[model samples]
Target: MDISKLKEMPYDELRVLYKQHLHSLNISKATINTASVDTFYLWRKDSKTLFWDTVLSNDFESEARSRLLKTLSEHSSGNVNALVSGYLSHLRKFRLYISSDSTWEQSETNQVKTEKNTNLRRTKKDIVIPSPTVEQVEFYLTKWDGLENYHLQEDALNKLFLELCPNNTDILDILLKASTLNDFYSTNIFSIYPVAKHIRSLNIDTRLDAGDVTLVRDIQHVTISNKKRSFYSFATKYCSHHNPLDYPIYDSYVDEVLRYFRNRDNFSDFQNDELKDYVRFKDILIDFRGFYGLGTYNLKQIDQYVWQLGKDYFPKNYGKKKRGDK
Candidate 1:
């Protein structure tokens, strides 16, 4: 943390400390490894092609800056400026580590490294994830209100359900439509009828209980091709579409967003696994609202806020990821 001490530390020790610093900042193991701070002694090399061109120069432009600034700001020292200066100095040392055959070349490397680190330091000092505020939430809500495509689709689906699935008397058709529109592909085609029947049996209209959500999720044990499948996320979405006020939807985006904030803010005390439980997930969302002074928003508003925030900040690798992946 004391960037000033980086120069004095041994090469191996610097690698360890840098890796630990990244872990403390909650950077993924994959990212830390790819940075190769430990694997290749990235800090000891003074080439732009090393960590800079490959990792820091390409991905997570805003995220890296924000996280670094936020971590330093929250340090016990509470002197963001001094800490960032130390960090700049450390990066300078990194760029100055070139081994050249000639003194002139080494001098050129030192000059370039000094210039790059000076710019890097200035940029790092300005990096920040603007603190959450009521105005910012309202801005996002307004943005949500102006949306056209997704909202139109959602509105149409809600309308169809209003006309067809008012009370779940016979909702197999409506359920199928909902699944298609919502991309609930995890549920088997044949299993939809049984899930609908199960929901009809519960008669979960106008109100929803925690047990109701759990029962809906657990009751479906249909096996197709000897593969047992339970539509837990789909079940939550189904119940939420029915009663948005009582049931908050659960999906990977929501899950990641919750975990990110929980790690950063300590808003609530719950395990990551607890998010799978509808009761606890809803409670955690409530706690998030309270912690951020977002009491004016309802559960649905909070859901929209966090869902959009997740999509923006923690996007999925869409080419390799699917719904329900954590």
Candidate 2:
């Protein structure tokens, strides 16, 4: 979209545009909603805080600036791929409303919003359980009980999903509905399928739970190219006894965004130090949410933004150099 048009559009208008665009691309409302929330946060983060602005400030003693300029200078004359990669790095890191680094002022500002009377953007609701079928619910519980992490890792994962997923009940109800629907594969069992596959692969004596099939399908569904590695390639080892499919996986987007926002060469570097600063990370999330006026968000949505940004920016550098090409 034209930068002016994008900036000019209101939140409601932006939502409509997102839905239309994603619809055209055959992306589901669930997926689009996830992406839309991400875009909203990105814009919000870029607009509100100096986290990003500080990086490109061009002042000496500005560590981010020195690193960024050094990077660009090195790649500018030598490699289109590297230069474009650097540019993409900055965009993902210092995204719409947040900064690469945190600040005391940013923390104060978000704290103020949470100061008791801060009007809620969306109603925070409790977990709403829909009555599917008595037999089905019992069976699901039984299956869940049989699972290794039924009360532990699996529970942790579910808590994360519930806290983050905006249309939480809908997805939950879908899981419950599918189990007894008996269509199995036809029930868009894609998401849960991978979890089941992973579980069975581990030689873990586990039965498929309510959302298991859909989870699995989601893992390898879009991954049409088996020859190409997954973004969650690191999980191969940690995921031995555990089901990697059960986890909501992120691609390079998460890494790219962190790299951009941190002005770091990579996410691994930032994690080493900044991970200690919980307040800083919370500020990052809050600034991002308000910048986009997105309803609710979690880390996965952040991943999607980075992924989208990568896909958005990479092609320009793929074939030729802008300054030296063709």
Which candidate has the top score in TM-score?
Answer: 1
Q: Against the correct fold, how does model 1 do in TM-score? A: 0.55
**Candidate 2 residues 24-105, lDDT tens each?**
3332344444445433332343442332343334561344444444543443333222223333333333233132132113
Model 2 residue 305 CA deviation in Å:
2.2
Per-model C-alpha lDDT, please? 0.54, 0.34
Q: How much lDDT does candidate 1 score? A: 0.54
Residue 39 error, candidate 1, Å: 32
Off by over 4 Å in 2: 1-198, 203-248, 264-295, 316-326
